[model samples]
Target: LTFDDCNKSDRAFVAGVLRKHGFGATFYVTEGLGFLRNKENYVTWEEIVELDRMGFEIGNHTRTHPHMPGLSPGEMRKELLHIEKRCKEHGIQKPTTFCYPGFGHSLSCVRELQRLNYLFARRGVGPEFKDGGRGGRGPAYDPGVDHPLLVPTTGYAGPDWKMKDLMWAVDQAREGRIAVLCYHGVPAREHPWVNCNPEDFRKHMDYLGEKNCTVISMSDLSLFVDPRKGPEDPYAPIRARMKREK
Candidate 1:
């Protein structure tokens, strides 16, 4: 499980629930999206440190959340490095995982993450499934076939996502495939589009627990797949999957 955008509810609500069930998740942090100015909706650096202390993986979501495809390599580097610098100052270990801001990524972004030595990165399901806006379905991560930098999200929680969708996503975690899930605030106030209702979030977590799913952080993937290895043609698996679906 992965939570994005440094939502304050992560500290207030999400952490307690995860702790209660002994589940592991990654909380991707960033200073953008009025995070510094809007404490009501976002988490503070101190709270971010507390999250790291809680043993949840803290991954980089860039300094300012921007569409990565729109930025030059230098700009992207700067954005990522700024977060790394902050993590250092706060005594949080350098993040080995990254999430593309707004799910906007490109080969340039992929190369930049590789240069930074990120072990894994997550992107929205696309080029196979049409962009689902905020929450939608996509292929599970097949490490043997997909690029580590282009790991696809099996599901993202939003207004459109439901319990059935969550079940379908988790079901894909078999035969060496991983179902990577993305979520925002349990009750994301500022970003209503990606908001997951608190009740629904609890139900989802409960379901995972009941089913005995081995929920893991993004960094945990390294234990199963070598980060340095990637398919010869990154998009080939996606194309083949699309053809099979058709």
Candidate 2:
């Protein structure tokens, strides 16, 4: 399971819940807002450091959480670099995984992320790069079959998500496939679009425990992913085809 946005209150809340069950999650931090405390009840740099010490994986969610598709290559690079720098300054380990801000990404940014040595990047459920835009939910992730940069999530856990939806996604995880679940906040109203009620959140965690699901951090999943595989650019072949016609 993965939590995004790095909410301050959720930090302790989530950690307590997971620790009780002996599970851990990857908290995707946006250091720009975190350092500035721009979001109400957002985690501070010190708290982020504490999260790491508590045995949770702190993954990068960019510096400012910009709409990735709209960022120029330079801006995108800065987003990752700045967060990496901030995390390092606070003695946090350099994050090897990234979660797309607002579930948004540009195909161009994929190569840049690879250049930066990010082990993997997560996107919401969808056929990756569909119609040249990003979006997709998954049945389960087979690392050998999925692109490293465009890893598919099972789905987002928000007001619209029912327990059945989560159970279905978890059921998809058997046979060496991974179910990557995304959540924003617990009792999350700060960002209504991605909020999950605390009670509902517990139920999901309890379910995982009851079923004996192997909850893992993104970096844990990275061990099985082959970075050298997949299209360097999904469009590369298309671009080559165009060149031939030209």
Candidate 3:
């Protein structure tokens, strides 16, 4: 599972929960927002470093969260590069993985990311939520078949998510596929739309513990991906069509 946007107030709470469960998470941070000090503020550099000390993956979520598709190529590159630079300055390893701010993406931005040497850039929601249906984020992500830059999540667990939805996602991890759950703020009072109740979050963690599911940080999934294989060439189909036209 991964958490996005550094909510300062919930940092300790979220970290404590993960520690208790012996699980790790990737926290996608935006350092530009690190100045404010309140429930609505991003965590400080010290807190980010502490999370790193606790073994959580500190990933790039840009220097300031922005709509990627709307930014120029230079602007987009700055967003990613600045975060990578900040992580290193803070004694954290350069972030190899990235998450799109607001699920925004563009092919041009992707190209820039490749140039900057990011191993992965995640975007998009996972499965559809249904009532009394086969609840899941659809087919589990097969690194062999999917594009590395556009990893999908099982689903977004918000304030309204129930235990069943969480369990359904975990169950989908079977058959060599992974259920990547996207969580925003754990019980974020300010962002009620994406806020997941603290108790519910605990229940979800408890469920994972009871099921004995292996909860890994996003970076760890790299073990299963073969760098030799690489992501599919985006222009291959276009090139093929042009050749056929000839």
Q: Which candidate is the best by TM-score?
A: 1
Using TM-score as the measure, name the better of candidate 1 and candidate 2: 1
lDDT per residue (tens digit) for residues 30-54 in model 1 = 9999798999999999999998999
Q: Against the correct fold, how does model 2 do in TM-score? A: 0.86
Q: Report RMSD for candidate 3.
A: 5.5
Clashing residue pairs, candidate 3?
127-137
Candidate 3 matches the true fold with a TM-score of 0.85
Ranking of models by TM-score? 1, 2, 3
Q: Please, what are the lDDT tens digits per residue for candidate 2 over residues 1-246?
A: 788887865566888998899886899988554447555668777788888998989898998888899999899999999889988899989999999987776687787888898888887664432321221245366665566777778867766677887888888887777888888778665667567778888898999999998788888875666666776564443344346656
Using lDDT as the yardstick, the better of models 1 and 2 is 1
Strongest candidate by lDDT: 1
**lDDT value for candidate 1?**
0.92
Candidate 1 residue pairs in clash (backbone atoms < 3 Å): none
List RMSD in Å for every model shown: 1.2, 5.0, 5.5
lDDT of each: 0.92, 0.76, 0.73
